[model samples]
Target: MARLPEPLTPLIQRTSIRQVGRILSNTQLSPFSMEMRISWNAPQTLPVPGQFFTILPCRYPLTLLRRPFAYSAVTESWFAFIYDIVGPATRDMAKLKAEDDADWIGPLGRGFPLPSPDVKPILVAGGAGVGPVFFLSNVLAGRGSAHLVVIGAREAKRLIRLEWPSHAEVRLCAEDGGTGITGTVIDGIGQQDMADKVFYSCGPAPMMAAVHRLAAECGCPSWVSVEEMMACGVGACQGCAVAAAGNGGPQEYKRICDEGPVFASGDLIW
Candidate 1:
């Protein structure tokens, strides 16, 4: 069951517009994350890297349901979301302030696919999923491609500081060893070199099911970015169902807000 690869499909067909976005800076990166920074008015397309976006607060309306996130760092006009305040609609979206006004929608769902240039792309992030694996390791270092990011946190002020990706090759786990390579992220994917590498995970859910069981025991080929809990980011509220691997009948369910918050870790059911 390892023949997945073919889900990138989004050259255009993006029409989601609730629109408003204007905040522009909210700060506080770790110790429970939060990076807000919106402004984007360019929306006919623009959100790649495990796409997602939902926001809805407009002067603190607590929670009616729009919260989704992901897509940390984009710039045609502006975009950035690194959330993790946890409750009360992300603590009222960190009390938004720089010019306030929020009520978005997005380049929603399905993203993170681009890995067949002869393997080697790793990624992995955890907790606030380090903003779409630092926006997919800066789009795999702007396509020059040398990748391998890792990230993970649980100490060291709960990491997530951002501004990495100078050509990727980061790695900073910290399950309390205080920083860089101490534990978790499966001990930084067990010190890398997973043969022809391909993984591309994103935060919790047992750390993306232990990086898809160590990328299927190193036979490598993985992808995930699911994070659930949505009332309706789209897909009309099937309520973010997950769990679907092969035959269970009727495709057994799949819609982390519309067919994926990026999938293909052997197509779910972990």
Candidate 2:
């Protein structure tokens, strides 16, 4: 495994879960993806930018486990999640109509630390990982923080081109050179001065590992949002355990949904 830089512990606060939510709109973004905006009635508080939720489909039976999805964006009364259709759960979710109900449990897990106004923020995302990272990017914009955004996908169509804040510099990458650069998202990072900036990333493990490696090389502390096969979406299942970073001691494991779906980059033994 590649060595990643040590990351700062994120600011954490536990959030209550909502039992039900109504879908306001469910629009297909591409052949395999869709975006849903939902009304959760009254949330204890708005979810921090990097948090995720576990959504249970009221209509699916074969799929017993709730699907975990990161918040792509949020508003006062509504929140959005973007998902790619890969299994029975998501395929059923795609059939949700406006006014349909979906059970939800979240704003679960730790979120990325807020960046200081004086620090430049850089966000890197690949594939479906764009969901959370884009939310964080919007939060940065709301804070009046300028940022650089790098996104990668298998092809141009897989890449998301959202209306990011005007202050953000967006870079695109595709493995097939179908959109921007011809390489991985890590290749898009190039040789920018990461040392002076705060870095946040989410994606396939290999991509994130590369990002963390680059951060280590540049002496940049980073935060990473990770994905795992989840069962309960809460601590009860004891599923989704990931190894903790560091050796020379007892090996430790952290639960993805309960302990985090987000963590300081190098803290995970990737």
Candidate 3:
């Protein structure tokens, strides 16, 4: 991994129009990739690495509060969010343009804890799951931690390029072997004891599940971000819950909105 430089962490207190700004147009990173910059009206609080922010669409019934988007990257003035148009909420989000304000709130939820400074060769990310990890890597790179990236996708064409502060040595894996190694991402772990390092992942449920199992086998501490259908982005509604980390499991569901969009790999039923 190349060294990523760090910027100062910002202070966050609440959400307001003071924080939400119109889109400044978007950037096409790849044929399938898009990046958007929402203008922040003031010196918004910098999102600590691993933390996320919620964007309430510009409408009411706040119960459909807003979709929680991970803090892709943050600075003193503005922050960027990346998304693919997979459904209605995203389709609407994709249409946002410059000067068009959207309801926004956050710097919400805890992020993955940074790995110990003594540890390097940390495993990084792939695809949309890249959001929180990107923010985390930005902070870690600045401190000279080295990392390895094993990004997986169904095919090479589906992979998206991101601005990695450290730009760790990237490894690619695909189901079709269209690029890099062919097989599930866990194929990369090679049965090596991954103890002492951290594994951070976010993606489809099945993928995260497989990763959870792999992390356990390697004895690596892992973190994952859960994706669930949600109405209220905050804890009020019970729409987005998953099986719990406890013995009873989903018998006691964990709310994705309130309990977590992120969790320790062991604390989830999947």
Candidate 4:
């Protein structure tokens, strides 16, 4: 594992907000993915890109634990997430209709750090990781930063549809060559000039590891959002521990929920 000179620190630390959010829409984005929009009252602080929230189906008594999801889009009184229907909880979530209420705790965990004004931003996302990267691209665009977004999936049907930010450039790739670029996200990334650019990625473990290696080769800083099976959305259960590289010191573990879902690529033993 590689290590950067400075350690990555938690950027946001506000107390978690628990609320019953009303479902505004539950739309299917692709064959395997669904987008759920929720609206709440009392206007709370919006979540930053890469921060996650845990949601539980109010009607499903069989589901014991809440599932963590990253924000795909956000507004003043509403937010949305893109989820894959992979388990009992997500299946139930897909069944939910408008006007239903779901229990959720939000704005938890750390988020991606803002890039310096002089550096270009390159965001890579695949599978379920597209949500946060999409949100981040909009944020960067709002700040007058032109960035590149690379999204990948196994096939065209698996790719998510979104009203992408107009200011940011996008590259789409699929393994089956059913979409934009006929290769993986790495192939799209390879076409860019990496100098003076910072990389942020989220996807399957193997894909992120590949991005980390590419970033290292380009001598660019990289941050990754890790996906793990989390029993507790908080650090109490210690269920989502990722091994730390420790640089030259003793190895340790960091909690993905508490310490980060976002971390410097060099900070973890990928």
Clashes of 1: 0
Candidate 4 residue 45 C-alpha distance from true site, Å: 3.1
The C-alpha RMSD of each candidate to the native structure, in angstroms, is 15.9, 3.2, 4.8, 2.8
Stretches of candidate 4 exceeding 4 Å from the true structure: 1-10, 42-44
Please provide, for model 4 over 122-186, each residue's C-alpha lDDT reduced to its tens digit, 9 standing for 90 to 100.
89998889999988999888989898888988787899877888878898999999889988889
- Whichever of 2 and 4 has more lDDT, that candidate is 4
Q: Among these predicted structures, which one has the highest TM-score?
A: 4
Task: Give TM-scores for every candidate, taking all chains together and pairing residue i with residue i.
Answer: 0.35, 0.92, 0.83, 0.93
* lDDT score, candidate 3: 0.66
Residue pairs with backbone overlap in model 3: 4-141, 4-142, 50-111
Model 2 clash pairs?
Answer: none
Q: lDDT score of model 4?
A: 0.85
Cα displacement (angstroms), candidate 4, residue 41, comes to: 3.1
Model 3, position 142: C-alpha lDDT score: 79
On lDDT, the leading prediction is 4
Give lDDT tens digits, candidate 3, residues 126-216: 5676666666677678778777666677877777677565547666778887877787677754555454667778776777788888767
Q: How close to the true structure is residue 179 of candidate 1, measured as C-alpha lDDT?
A: 73
Judged by lDDT relative to the true structure, which candidate is superior, 1 or 4? 4
lDDT per residue, candidate 2, 1-270, as tens digits? 112322324345565566787889999877777889889765657777677888887666567777889999988788898888888778888998999888888778777777766678789997678889888888788878898999988878887667788878999999988878889877887766555676789888998888888777777778889887798877788889899886779998898888788887778886
Q: Which lDDT values do the candidates have, in the order given?
A: 0.79, 0.80, 0.66, 0.85
Ranking by TM-score: 4, 2, 3, 1
